[model samples]
Target chain A: MTELLKVTGLSRRFAGGGLFRKRKVFHAVSDVSFTLKRGQILGIVGESGCGKSTLARLVLRLIDASEGQVTFDGVDMASLPRRELRRLRQRMQLVFQDPYSAIDPRYSVRDALLEPFKVQGVKLGSPDEKVASLLDMVGLNTSLARSYPHQLSGGQKQRVGIARALALNPSLVVLDEPTASLDVSVQAQIVSLLERLRHELGLTYLFISHDLGLVRYFCDQVLVMYLGRVVEVMPSDAEPAHPYTRALLDSSFEPDPRQRRTITRLSGEVPSGYDLPAGCAFANRCPRVSDLCRGVLAPLSTLPNGQQVACHNPLIDAALPAACR
Target chain B: MLLTVDMLRIRFGAFSPVDQVTLGVDRGEILGVVGESGSGKSLTATAIMGLLPRIGGQVAGGSIRFDGTDLVDLPESQMRRLRGGRIALITQNPMTSLDPMMRIGPQIDQAARLHLGLGRSAARARSLDLMADLRIPDPASVYDLFPHQLSGGMKQRIVIAMALAGDPELLIADEPTTALDVTVQAQIVQILVDLVRQRGLGLILITHDMGVVAQACDRVAVMYCGRVVELARVDALFEHPRHPYTQALIRCIPRNGMARGTMTAIPGMVPTGMTQPPGCRFNPRCARVESRCRVDIPELLVGPSGNGVACHLAEAA
Candidate 1:
């Protein structure tokens, strides 16, 4: 597989406190590195404050990275000039988490979809024809083009968002919890739509969601994050390689009532970003933490199947042979 | 049974939010109410606890009997004493439920002192003991910290601790784990289950997730359009759902081993509050709808093995 997007040593920090006092720095994204292959979906799973959104914004250059490099299709995104960056926006797009807030209430669906083309100053033969095609592709009727955001349901509004993202035919789309706000039944519809669109258009995706079940069903590779750090990176075909990943998988309750298993609950709470601990960020809550794990930070180590994990222990038995342990 | 709701109807202005809903919780049973938003699950729980807002709602008809006493007819002063003493509610969003300016220890202690008649010192000591039982790290330190200082999971635990302060016979938890992560959700469910078992208390768990309902509930009640559409043993309901809405809901969830892009979704959105259809509210979305469903409402028909269903097909069968 050829790499479509490569990010190395990406970091973002913010300074706090008034100017009179020494400012305290908060590291939102800490030395994160990952690669997205062509036509592959990478799911970033984490809690609310784990900085997954910050990483997505950095990739889209909606916000700048404090340190590290981002290369997309042999071009350095961080080094691009304003004119070049604006041109690159046509090839990469973002779908926000909340469909209600992402779409403008004042604009009709047709105007929302045509804004991308209008911003690029592209004079197509007929904008209405393109808008109609986009709506049909996203499973919405062309007649809905004149409807306002409030006139559509949550699922319909999300479909409009997807249509707008594909208006410029972007190769890479970053989706942030596209189905979190809808009903379970409506969520199923949107997931199916997204899967079909990915295959039909040959689009790559960076899917960010906290729902583990949806992630397991949607992405080809999964990255588990905690406290602004990647804890595990596992291929979707294999079992997870870290204890935190296993805990997340085990915590998912089956819909059938007959199945029962003892759950190993992680103790304590996630530490605040303002006062992070020195060693492993998960040490306070990890059940398998050892003395070494508490005193030293773990680097990403590649496994047999080219999966990377960043834990001192790594739940090695679950990932590799005994000889490796 | 500790609590029984018989044909309870709650109305907001001219709209009937809860229409002839009937259910009950035994002394030591956890009855899970599963439904989507606008299904009136929360409103039903609030009505039973006498905590409904006075803006536009009233208990239009029927009765909520607790320990053979009707709660709907009780005075405000008398209902206030029974609320925290016999029935307690644990809301989903704990951050908003807790006061940010107050310390955890005093907030929990206050509940005990007010309802259980424990002295200030005794309540404070008991608060520490309850925190320890919940496996809160450094309970002594956490007791002095304010609400903003605690994490999401810790704040939830504090809410649960406060609910347990009065030693109530019934615990009404409304979407208690919806806002937490899956790992934290499992931990909280285990804690609630263990607490209920240890105290032999009745629990009413209201949530939208069918997975949580299957694992945590003994008996499951499927609510739709403000009515209990189906009520059965958890095993029975999962194996064979009688109502069309229940079947569609179960089929909609993506299971663990299922292939991607193969999930089946029920078409059409839920109807709004003001424009519910006359006969059967779910008729527009029901796949098995017939002409009879559009003109007449169905009563809860007792089916095999003590199951209750409110569908025309189930009633005929």
Candidate 2:
């Protein structure tokens, strides 16, 4: 499989304070790297303030990376000129976290969906036909095109957001917690719709969410992030390597009442971005932290089946082995 | 029984927010109420505490008998006295529940002083002790700090401490852990479980997560569309859920070790509050829906070992 998106050594920082006062720098994302193949769903799972959304924004070039290289189909995305980047934007679209805020309240669903085409200076002869088709693709009725966002339900609005994202027929779409605000049944419908769209349109996705179960279900590969760094990257079916990843997996709340809860509780608060500690960011909360882990930053090491983990003492023992070991 | 809700029905205008929902909580028992958003789980808790919003929802029918007193018919002044002194509620968003302008110690101490009738100095001392018990590091420092200065987890602990300050016999925790992170969620659950056990308080835990219910609740009541569809021992309900809605809800959750794209979700959306289906509200979404389910509302039929299910199929079976 060829890579559609490749990110290497991505770093983002924010500097603040007045002229007299000392400037403080916050490392929001640090040395993050990953590859998303064409038509593949890459899941980025992390808690709030972990820079998951920041990484997504960096990939979209919504915010310029402080230092890094982003290659989209072998083209340098970060270094591209504004005009070139604008053209590339049609190929790579982003679906925001909140549908209510993402779409303009002043515009109807048809206008919202057509905004992308209008921006690209590609005027469709029959705008209504294109809008209706996009609505149908996302399982919405053609009549919905006339409705405003406030008139529609949360699920219906999200469908409109998806239709708008697909207006340009982009090859890659970045969905940030698409179903977080939706009802359980509606969430299921949206997930199925995404799966169907992926199969039908051959769309590649970077699905970012805090939901572990949803990530494990929808993604082909999963990336565990903590404090702006990828702790572990593995195939969805493969056993997780890092303890943080394992803890995340274990802590996920299951719906089945029959299933016994096996949550491995991790203590300590998430360290502030303004004052991050040296070495491993997860060392403070890790249950099996050692002196070596506290002193040195762990590098990504490959295991069998192409899984990679970033930890001095990776949780190899916790990983369920071959034939349920 | 510490608390008993019998055929309770809450209405807002012509709409029924909670329809004839009946359940009981014994002394020292954790009764978990599991359902999705707008399922009336929160409304049921509010009704129990006599804190239902005045404008819309009102106790139109039935009774809430807590310790042999009908709380629904109680005077406002009496209910206000019972609100924190005998029965306390910890809502989902602790940030909104706690006063932002006040320091943690003063807010917590206020509850102790008003409910427990303790002096100012004694209440302050008790508040600090409660904060320490909740594992808030540097209790003295945290006491002086405002609510905004603390983390989400710490703010939640302060709320829990305030709820416990009154030493209430019954604690209604409505989605207490939904706003918390997973790691912090586990810790909060542990604290609540330990507290309930130590004090022998009846706990009514209302949440959307079934996992939380399974871990903490001894008995479980599954609510849907403002009604208790099933009630049973935790183990029994998990082993064999009688109601179709209960089964569907369990199936909807994405489980670990399941293959990608293999999750089974219940079809159709939760019906809006203004217009619910006539017969069984879940009939439209249920896979096992029969003709009888669409026309007649099923009564709570007793099953094996006191387990109860409100379903036409279960009644026939």
Candidate 3:
């Protein structure tokens, strides 16, 4: 498999609250690892505060990982020299969640597209020509070059964000809930645009979203996370093996009353991220939790169908622990 | 019908974003008003609540009737009495709905005391019962707790409890679960549905989620720009959506095991107030648009069964 990005045991810890020596480390992302194939969309699905966004930043090396490493194109990004890292950032771009705030209101569409080149200090043949092509690439009207962010719609602003990300022709683009704030119809338009861009550019995506339906529809493979831990990794078509994954899938209301799920919902608040359980982080709310599950960290076992699940009582017979230490 | 908003037109200064909105709500059922942003779904709810004046909006034309009473020009005093007593509103954000400093029970107690004229002890008794009915754990203890001490889901339950405290006959919840997580959203929706059935209250559930409409609503009104384009029974609406906007929206829902590229996006944006389309508001983005669609406004024709469609093509069909 041509893996564009391979993350191994990535962890990000935050010193929560209180200044000075009263240190309480919250593991924002712990023991998370996944592979994004070249030209493939690997979706990371979770609820709010599940570290999906934090993991995205960690993958792009926007923030340092407290533990483990991210190897991009078979190169350790952490070990790369500062100068090399800056050059490498061109190959790895990020699209923010809110299209409204992602772009500067001060910058016109033309200026926004050209800012990437200016930041990289790359001299183009014609900056205006480059702007036109980038806008055209994103299917925006060339005349919108003069319009500011306020003048553009939410979908248009998002198109500009995507165009900006593609300006440098990045191989890996980490989209962080890019359509969460958008209306449903506009979200569909953005998804279609992203898909087209991926096909045309042969780009790989690390799409982080809270919407399970959208992820299953758009992604090639799914990585379900609960409180900063990767609980399940399966192909989009596979039935989710993890209970947490199933809960997420059950969360979104299906558009048919006849198919409405009978009322067994995952109750209880998500445990504090810092004060996670001793054994499985999911044991508190896990429907299939047992004494063994509560007392021990679940091994991420791979099934025959290549679905990886980290649970003592996985819905599907899962994989052996891949190397937690 | 507990509530009927017929040919409702709302204006914000010179610009009217919502025009010709017509829908009905009966006791013991949920009537979902589903639409995107600027679709005037919320405006209709606000008009029903008689809070349009507070939001710089006015009922430009048409009428809102509740229990055979004309509510359009009802005096403020009567509207106030009707608001919390019979027409309670549950807004999207529960965090802001409750007073942070006040105890949860007292906040709920205020509704019962003001509307039902219950004494202090009686209001407290009623609040606890409402909280218990909402399935909140240890309602007795939770009644004494502050809003900040509660989780998002719990806080929303408290909001629902307060709405019920007033003993409302028609509950209008405008995107009540939009601020919450999907898991929490489902729970909240279930609570609302139960409230409708058990309490036998007419519910106007305003949301942008078609999925929620399918799951929670008995009947649904599909709005575009400022008008209800389609209104039908939940089963019939899902079985065969008539309006082009409604069809496009249904197609966009990512169904289970749905193949890639099957979700078709409606091209172009929903025209805002300033840029309202001349003919059918949806004609610009509609694939089946013809000369007739671009020249005249289609009237929302409700059939004998109360199913309605506002498209010229649907009329032709």
Candidate 4:
């Protein structure tokens, strides 16, 4: 598979403190590196304040990164000129969490779809025809184009949001918690729509969400983040070997009672981003934390079958799963 | 039964949001009220807490008996005494539910002071103990901190602490962990389940997540468009969901072994206040809907196993 995006050692640090006080440097996205192949969905799973959202922004160049390189389609996005970067934005798009807030209150469905084209400076053959076709592509009725966002259902509004993301025929879509606000049935519809669209349109997706079950089911590969670091990266179908990943998987409540598993409850809370520990960020909460784990940084190392894990003691052996091999 | 709600109907003026909902909770049991948005699960919970009037709702018809006391006709003064004393509510968003100006200690202590009628010192001690019970590290420090000062999980723990301070016989948690992350959500659910077991308090957990129901609840009531479509034990509900709505809900969630493109999406949107169907509310979206389902309203009927279903086709299942 051809590589669509390559990120190396990307990091973003935010400094906050009173004018005279000691400045606190928060390592939001610390030394994260990953590659996305064309037509592949890479899911980033993490809890709040884990910098999943920050990594998404850094990749799209929506926010400046403190360190590392973001090469999109072999072009370094950071060093690109302002005009060139704006032009490059047409190839990458984002769908935010809340459909209600992501869209303009005053703009109609047609206007919302058309707004993307106008901003991207892409001239369509016919704006009306394009808008209606966009609505149809996302499974919305053509008649609803004239309606405001408030008049539409949550699912319909999200369809509109998806349509707007696809307005410029972008190759990569960064969907940040797209289904988090919608109802489960609606979430199902949206997930199905995204899957179909990705296949039909040959699009790559960077799906950032807190829902582990959905990520495992939908993503081609999963990247588990903890406290601004990539703790585990595995094939979607493979069982994770990191304790943090296992804890996250165990934490998710499955719908089937027969498959009910006890949650490996992690003691203590997520540490403050500003005052992160000197060792591994997740050492305090890791079930297998030892003296060495608490004092030394755990390096992300590749296993035999290419699944990368960052832990002193991995759950599964290096003998890879058959499917992954 | 610690609390029994029989055919409880909640109406906002002419539009009824909760219609003919019947469910009960036993001491030390967690009854999950599961549904989507606008499914009226929250309304039913608030109705039980005698809080429907606050949201411009009234108990149109039905009986809410708390240990044999009919709460429907009870006067406001009497209801006020019952609320926060025997029945406490835990709302969805702790950030919004909690007062930003007040410290966590005072906010939690106030519940004990009012409901338990404890002295200032007693309330403080009780609140701190509740916080500790919730596994909030450094309860003493957290007591003095503001709501904003704590994390989302910490804030929710404080909310749970306040709810427990009343020593309520029934705790109504409406989407308690919806705002929390998965790891934190697990912690909160564990805390709630432990509380139910220890205190033997009847818990009405209102959530849109079937996963939570499977993990935490003893029994489950599936709601759709203001109606209890199915009610059964959590294990039975997942194993053999009778109602079409309940079946569809189970199919929609991404289970562990589910493959891509296998997660079925229930077609058609949930009916609203204006477009509500005359007969079976879920018939339009139900895959097993029959001709009779389109015109006849299904009553909540009990099966041989004591499980209930409100569907014309449920008899065959």
Candidate 5:
């Protein structure tokens, strides 16, 4: 299984209405398709309401997809029997964004890690030894085993979350903004820890974040999303092909003051996801918008540098040759 | 200088969360107070706004001098007049500061009416002018909209307009754009920067994000464990971070074009609550932790140019 996970034509719709009114279906995710290979980190970068979190849930089967197929390890998740699906779930894991709310308030760190094994109805020889090892693996002191979520710091709580996710030795781990709630120093620690863990365990990751600099630094490939659709996918070192991706890159402030640019801030608010635009979601704010962009949705097309873009007027600049780093 | 906070210390009974903070901001400058949670950055801002008493934090030592007036000895009655008149605060979440039941226009008008004592029509006219200045599209129509009707970015702009309504010389923004999206954050930050230049208002922006500090602030105070570890011009601070803590913090950020796998974390966790280490607060986590750092408290020593580092190693060298 060179390809650890393959998601095709994924679409998830959430119904919003009362009993007296007709159901208004909001497409939270639409036509999302991507393949994750072994030990590769695919970073999904987007703003809020971009369906990156929902896509993570859909991939893990924590929530059912309205329409799509998720094939993991040559097994179609939709076609799997109930018992088989339960067994297959052990291979994939999700590390939640919020360290505060992800863990149970009452459960000790040790208990929280062991709950997964108990829920799966398996005992890995010795529970105490396993807990100690898991804590050690995530670089947390074993003494913190008895500490509750409230007692741990944000960085420590995130470490507990990571240790819990690794308890089952899952092949694919989906880290949904794992460091968003952390401070910069702690975030760097978590990023470095994640990097080390991936190397030690040979784990594949789907790292989702709003920070483009971080995504570029950490991932092998970068996927840009906007209003529940994939806008661009490029190598982490490449210049983006989509206008929305360019806007995202521009909006992020660089740490060095020397590289400061006069930000011609993107005009127009992000259109509400409940009432999605008929054409390109970014047409309202795009500097290079044309009549064709406002009239029709662009299909995902590949460029010479292996970057994928879904835009009528993509900024396929000369930087393409240097993109294949 | 519009505001000068010298050796400011705040205590809650036996615990002192904010200690020995010293920083100043000029009328046309943006001073960024950056730190992690419990780093006392927000508390420093709150102390300046004279709202520390609301959170049961009392100023234990030092002076907060605004316009040559020491606010330390100022009575609550006079502090009230200066709170939203001469100085104003913009918090992170707009909803918490804004009344949901009130119209957005009236909310902006409230500040001008209360602080400037303008009539109903004049306050409203001033609100519309402020809204326009903030680049809100069709200010008249948006004025009638409720806080819930507007998007997150628009709500933040309304909040900014309200802060401007007071016509204050100093504005304290406590993580104002933390709740907004990145794209909208850029817009709001740009607006703030423009407002600072156009109006010559002293801005003390409190945040945890280093990138925002570099992009917006003229000078930055790097806080760690309730102290200003490094204070310098934004360029100098980034280019030559002297303090180990400051250096580690800058290193942690994932910079553009930086090679992969080179990032390293500081060794230990920040000292929490009253469990502060002796000597330098960052000694436990410092890569160059000497015996002196663990035994002696290093005070921030600024040069004549107003750039300083509170590190034993930097102080020695």
Candidate 6:
């Protein structure tokens, strides 16, 4: 499989320092690295303030990374010149979470779709026809093209959002909670539409969502993030190994009432990004936390099963850790 | 039953958002009010709290009986005694519900002091106790901090603490954990369940998340466009949903081991305002719509198992 995108040690820090105060650095994303094969969907799952959004911005070059690099299709994004990068942006696009605010309320659905082409300075054969096709591609009716975003329902507006992102025929779409704002039924429609588009267009996706259930079903692989760092990466079909990942999986209640599992509670709040602990950020809340876990920061290590985990005491196959054994 | 709502109609001028909704909650029971956005779930909660008038809404017709007393006919002054005292509400966004300018302790203290008639120090003591009950760590420090200093999940816990400060008999949680993380949501749900069991309080949890309903609620009321289309025990509803809308809703959720793109999304949008379909609001989106569904309104028919459904297809199922 060809590597479509490669991010190495990507990190973003926001320095909070007033003129009279001491400088404080906030690591929003820390040493994140990933490889995305062509035509693959990678889901990043995390809670609020987990830096998944920052990681997404860094991957797309929407925000400058303080450290590391992003390579897209064999081209280094950081090294690319402004003009070239702008042109290259045509191959990558972002679909925001809230479709209501993503597009210009003043613009009609057609104008929103065409705005991407205009921004990219791409001329099309019969732009009107292209707009109609874009709408149709996203499973939207052609009649909605002239309607303003306010006039459309949440689901319809999201369809417009998807259409706009695909206006330039982007190869990779970074979807940030695209269905979070829609109702479950509408979410199902959008999810299915995205799946159809992926197979039909051969498009790769980087899905970032808080809903683990949706992530597990929609994505091929899942990255569990905690306090700006990747805790674990596993196949969506497999059960997660890391304690944080397992806790996340356990926290999500399944829709089925007959098969209810007791929630595995994780005590303590997510640590502040401004001041990270010396060792594991999850140690405070991890049920399997030990003295060793509190002493050393666990690096992302490839397990025997090929899954990557950054926990000193991962519950793989529900096996006890070596220390306990 | 601790609270009974019969033919509750909430209207804004000529626009009736919620119409003829009937539901009940027993002591120590969690009745899940399930609905999509604009499905009148929140409106129903507000009406129960005597907050409809503040939002320019009024109960056009109905009987809201609480502890064998009619709440609808009570004056504002009398209802105010029960608003936060006995019937407490926990909204989705805690940051907005909480006063940003006030410290967490004082904000929570105000609820107990004003409603429960506790002294300042006693209210302070009760506030800390409530926070501790909600599993908030370092309650002392959190008590002094403002709403902005706390995370979304912590803020929601504080909101729950404030609601519990009054030791209310009936709790109305309106999407209480919607803004929080899934992990935190589970914790909150567990806490609410524990509270209901321990204190024997009736809880009305309004949310759009079907999973939360399955996990926390005893009885589920599935609302569509301002009406209760289906009502049943949580287990029975998920196992054998009678209404087409309920069936479609259950099918649409992305569950474990479920293949991608196989979810049957109900076609068309939910009807809003007075423009709902005459007979059945869900008929436009429902795939199993019969011609009779378009002409006559279906009554809430009860099955042998006490599962209530308002659909022509209910008997067929």
Model 5 bad stretches (over 4 Å): A99-102, A322-325
Work out the TM-score per prediction: 0.95, 0.95, 0.97, 0.96, 0.98, 0.96
Error of 6 at A127 (Å): 1.5
lDDT tens digits, residues B1-317, model 6? 89989889988999888887888899999999999998999999999999899989899998999999999989999998988889899999997679898888998988788887899999999898889888899999999999999888889999999898887999999999888888888998999999999999999999999999999999999999998899899988999888899999999998888876677888888876667888888888878888998988887765655568889887743
RMSD of each: 2.2, 2.1, 2.9, 2.1, 1.6, 2.4
Clashing residue pairs for model 5: none
Taking the tens digit of each residue's C-alpha lDDT, what string does model 5 give over B1-317? 88999999999999998888999999999999998888898889889888888999899999999999999889999998888888988989989778999899999998889989999999999999999999999999999988999998888889889888989999999999998888888889999999999999999999998889999999999999999999999998999888989888888888888878988777778889879998999998999999999999899887888888888789532
Worst 10 residues of 6 chain A by lDDT: A316-325
lDDT of 3 at B167: 95
The window of 10 residues in a row where model 6 chain B has the poorest summed lDDT is B298-307
Over B198-310, each residue of candidate 3 has an lDDT whose tens digit, in order, gives 88999999999988998899999999999999999999899888998999998887888889888999999988669888889899999999998898999999988999999
Q: How many backbone clashes does candidate 2 have?
A: 0
Top-scoring candidate (DockQ): 5
Writing each residue's lDDT as its tens digit, candidate 1 over B178-269 gives 99888889988988888878888899999999989888888888898798888888888899998999999998887776777767788878
Question: What TM-score does candidate 5 get on C-alpha atoms?
Answer: 0.98
Per-residue lDDT of A1-325 in model 3, one digit per residue for the tens? 5988999999999988687657688989999888888999999999888999999999989999999989999899999999999999999999987654766789888888988888898999998899999999988999999998878888999999999999998999999999988899999999999999899999999999999999999999999998899999998877888998888887787877678775566756788887988888878787898998878898778876678989878776323233421
Those runs of model 3 whose alpha carbons end farther than 4 Å from true positions after fitting are A20-22, A317-325
**Candidate 3 has which clashing residue pairs, if any?**
A301-A318, A301-A319, A301-A320, A302-A319
Q: Score the docking of each candidate (DockQ).
A: 0.71, 0.58, 0.79, 0.80, 0.85, 0.82
Which of candidates 2 and 5 is the stronger one according to DockQ? 5
Chain B TM-score, model 1, reads 0.97
lDDT of 4 at B35: 93
Report lDDT (CA) for all predictions: 0.86, 0.86, 0.89, 0.89, 0.90, 0.89
Off by over 4 Å in 6: A100-102, A318-325, B302-306
Candidate 1 TM-score to native: 0.95
Considering just the first chain, candidate 5 attains a TM-score of 0.96
For model 5, give the TM-score of chain B. 0.98
